[model samples]
Target: MNEPISWVVAYPEIFLLVMSAVISLVDVGVKSRLRDTTYVLSLLTLAVVAYLLGASAASGETLRSFNNMVVSDPMGQWLKCFAALAMFATLVYGRRYAGDRDMLARGGEMFSLALYALLGMFVMISGHNFLVIYLGLELLTLSSYALVALRRDDPQAIEAAMKYFVLGALASGFLLYGMSMVYGATGSLDLAEVLKAIAGGEATLKGSAQVLVLGLVFVVAGLAFKLGVVPFHMWVPDVYHGAPTAITLMIGGAPKLAAFAIVIRLLVEGLLPLAVDWQQMLAVLSVVSLLVGNLAAIAQTNLKRMLAFSTISQMGFMLLGLLAGVVAGDSGNMANAYSSSMFYVITYVLTTLGTFGVILLLSRNGFESENITDLAGLNQRSPLYAGVMAICMFSLAGVPPLVGFYAKLSVLQALLASSHPLYIGLAVFAVMMSLVGAFYYLRLVKVMYFDAPTQTADIVAGADARSVLSLNGALVLVLGIVPGGLMTLCAQAIAALLA
Candidate 1:
C-alpha cells in the first residue's frame, strides 16, 4: 500500500497560494493607481491566513503532511501566524506610500508579489525537508528581488536589486552544495531521516563524518547569509538603502520570522546531534556580528542603512540564545534558550514595523525620508508619530521597561542561565554591544525632538495607517510591561518543537 499524504495539514499555505493567484488575476483588471481593490483583497487574504495559522497553533497538534515533507507544529504555526500579521501590517502601512511612488500605477503587482513572497515564507516555515526548505527560500528571495526593482525607472533600485540577486544566488548555491553533500553523507533528504542518520552514527560509521561536517559549514554559511549576519551581510545595507522604504520593510520585517523558522528546522531539528560543532561556529558569528553591526551603524547617515546594521546586531543576540541551548551536551536548557530567541525575534519585528511605519508616514510625494536628519523636529509636526518613532527607537535601543529591554534580558538570561563560562562571557559581551548600539538609536531621538523642522507641510496619513501604527507602537510598550503571555507562548511552542 502507498503511504498517504495529508493535504489538510497545510490549510494556510493552500489558502495563501490560491488567494495569491486569484489576487494576481484580479489585479489585472484593477486600474486604480492606489490599488484599493487589490489592497483590500490582499488584506482579507492575509487576515484569513493568519486566523487559520493561529487556530492551528491553538489546537496544538503536530502533523506531518505531503509524505512527511511538510509539518504543521505549534512552532511553525505561531511563526506563520506572526508572519501573516506582519504582512498585513506592512500592506497597511505601505499601501499609500506605494501609491504615492507610482508603485501601483500600472497594476497591483506589488500587492500580489507581496502575497507571493509571503507564501514563500509560509512554505519555508512549514517545510520539513531540505528541498522544500530551499524551494521556499528561493520563492521568497526571488520575489524580493523583483519587489526591490519594482521601481524600474530608478537606477538605485535596479542596482540594489542586481546586488541582491547576485548575492542571494551565491548564497542559494552554497546551501544547495551543502545539501548535496549532506545527502551524500546521510543518504536522505528528509530532515527526520537525516537526523536519524546522523544521530544513529550511520554517517560516521560509513566514514562520511568529515563530509557531513564540511557540509554543515556551508549550510551554516548559507543560513548566516539568509539571516543577514556579519561576513555574509553585504547585501543588507545596500538593499535597505536602495530599495523604496516600503519595500525595505517588506524585505526586513516578516522574513525574519521565516529565517528564524528555517534555522530551527535545519539546525535545531535536523542536525542537533552535532550541536557541539555548530555551537562554536554560531558563537563566533554572533560575536563578530555584534561588533561589526554596532560599530558600522555608528557611521551611517542613512536611517535605513543604520537599521540594517541594527538588524545584524539584533540577530547576533538572538543567535546567542541558540548557541546556549546546548551546554555540556545537556539538553535541559534547550527549550528556554530557543524560546528566548523566539521572543527576541517576535519583539524585534513588532518594533521594526512601528519604526518603519513612522518613516513611511513622514515621507510625502517627491520626498523620501531616508536620512537621520529627515526626522528633525518630527515632534513639532506630529507628536503622535514622534511618540511612535521614539518608542520604536527606545525599544530597539533595549532601554528599560520597553519590550526590547525584556527581549534582550531574556536572551541574556538564557545565556547566563546556561552556567557555561563561554556563554556567560557572551552575555557580558552582548551587553557591551547593546550599550554601544544605544548611541545611534538615541541620536535619532535627539534629532526628532531638538532640531528644527526642515519643512512645514502638514504630516498626513490615512486613518488605517495611523490606527495600525498607533496600535503597533502601543503593543511594543504594553508587551514590554507584560511579557509573560508571549514568553509563555514562545516556551510552549519551542517545547512542542522539542517534543
Candidate 2:
C-alpha cells in the first residue's frame, strides 16, 4: 500500500475546506442564536491559513505534490499570504454591517462561499497547468455569483446576480474555448510544457498560431471581466451598488489579488513566447480601461458605483507593469515590471479595503452608502474617521507619501523604461488620468471638511465599525510611510517566479 501523503503540502486549501465543511455542518445541525459564528470561523480560517503560509515561507521548501497539480513556491506563498490578509481585513470591516442589517442570518452561507472562493484562489496561485487554472477560476467565479445574490429578497441584488451570472457564463465559455484551442495547439495542458512548445515552434497546427492568439484574446477578455476592466466592466457598478456592503467589500478587496495571480500565471507563465502579440493587446486594453474607467467614473454620484469604476481604472494602471514585463523580454525588465505589478496589487487592496471600511462606518440600515453628499458632515461628526477617509481617498488618487502613489510611480516608471512608444504614451495618459481621478477624490475631501452636513443629523458610528475603520485607515498612511519592506517582498516574490 502507498503511504499517506503529508497533508501539510496542501495545507492552504485543506484549511479552507475543513473550515467550510465545519461551518456548513454547524449551520445544518446546530441551533445557534449568534449568527456571527460562521463569520468568526471564516476569519479564523484565514488566520490559520495565513500562519501556514508563513511557516511554508520560513521553511523555504518549494514542493510539488499531488503529481505537480499544485506546488508550493515563493510566488504562490506570497500571494496566498496577501490573499489571506485581504480576506481578513474584508471580514473585519464586513461582519458588523452584515449583522446590523440582519444580513447575518445567512451569513454562514456567505462565509462558506468566501472560503470556497479563497480555496480556488489558493489553487489558482499554485496552479501550474491550464486545468488547474480553469478549476480555480470556476470555483472562484461560481462562489462570487452566489455571494452577489446573498440577499435574495432584494430585487437589485437579484438583478445584479442575474446579470453577473449570464455575463460570467459567457466569459467562462470563451475562456474554456480558448483553453481548448491552446491545448489543441500545444498538445499539453501544462503551462511549462506549453511555454516550451511555443519557444520551440512546436505549436504548429492548422491556424495554430491564430487559434492560440484567439484563445488568448478570449482568455484576456474573460479575465478582464473579472478585473472590471473597461468595456468588459459593465457589471461592476450595478453589482457593487446592489450587493450588500459586506459582499461589496469582499468582491472589491481579496479577489483582485487572485485575478492578478491568475493573469501572471496565464499570460506571463503560459504565453511568454507570444509576448509581442499579447503585450500589444494588453497595452490597448490598458489604455482603453484607463481612459474609459476614469472618464466614466467621474460622472458617477453613487459612491459604490464610483469605486466600482475606479477599480476598473486601477486595473488599467496595474496592467502597465504586466505590459512592460512582456515588452521588455530578455532585458531583465520583465522581472522589475512583474514586481511593480505585485506591489501595485498590494497597495490597491489596502486602499480599497480602507475606503470601503469608511463606507461601512457611515452607512446605516435602510440607508445605502452610495453618495458623496453622505460624507459632507463626516469630519464634524468624527474627525478621526474623516481623516482616515481623507487618507484613503488621497491614496486612491495616487497622491504622494502614500502607498498608492508609489504603486502608480513604479508601474509608470516600468512603462517609461520600455522600448515601446505606444506604451509610454499610454503610461502618460494613465498619469493624466490619475490626476483626473484626483479631482473627484479631493471633492470628497472638500465635502468632508468644508461642506456642512446635508444628509442626516444622526450620524451612527458603531464601536466595531470605528475600531476596524481606524486601523484600516491608519494602515494606508503607515504602509505609505514604510513601503520599502512590502515592496522588497513583492520584488523578491516576482524575482523567484521569473527565476
The backbone clash count of each candidate, in order, is: 0, 1
Q: What would the TM-scores of all predictions be? A: 0.99, 0.95
lDDT of 1: 0.94
lDDT of 1 by residue, 329-442 (tens): 899999999999999999999999999999998898999988998889989989999899999999999998899999999999999999998899999999999999999999
Candidate 2 Cα errors over 4 Å, as ranges: 1-7, 29-34, 58-60, 205-207, 455-464
lDDT of 2 by residue, 1-499 (tens): 4345566678778877888899877766434443556756777788888988977865556777665566687778878888888888777777666766666564467667888888888888888888888898899889989988888788988898888899888888978888888888888888888898888888864448877888788888877887888788888888898888788888889888888998988888888988887787777778888888888888988888888888988998998898877654555688888899999988898888888888876777687766988888788887887898899999989898988898898899888878678778877788899998888789889989999987665656656557767877777888888989888888877777777
What are the lDDT scores of the predictions, listed in order? 0.94, 0.82
Clashing pairs in 1: none
lDDT of model 1 at residue 269?
88
Best by lDDT: 1
Candidate 1 has a TM-score of: 0.99
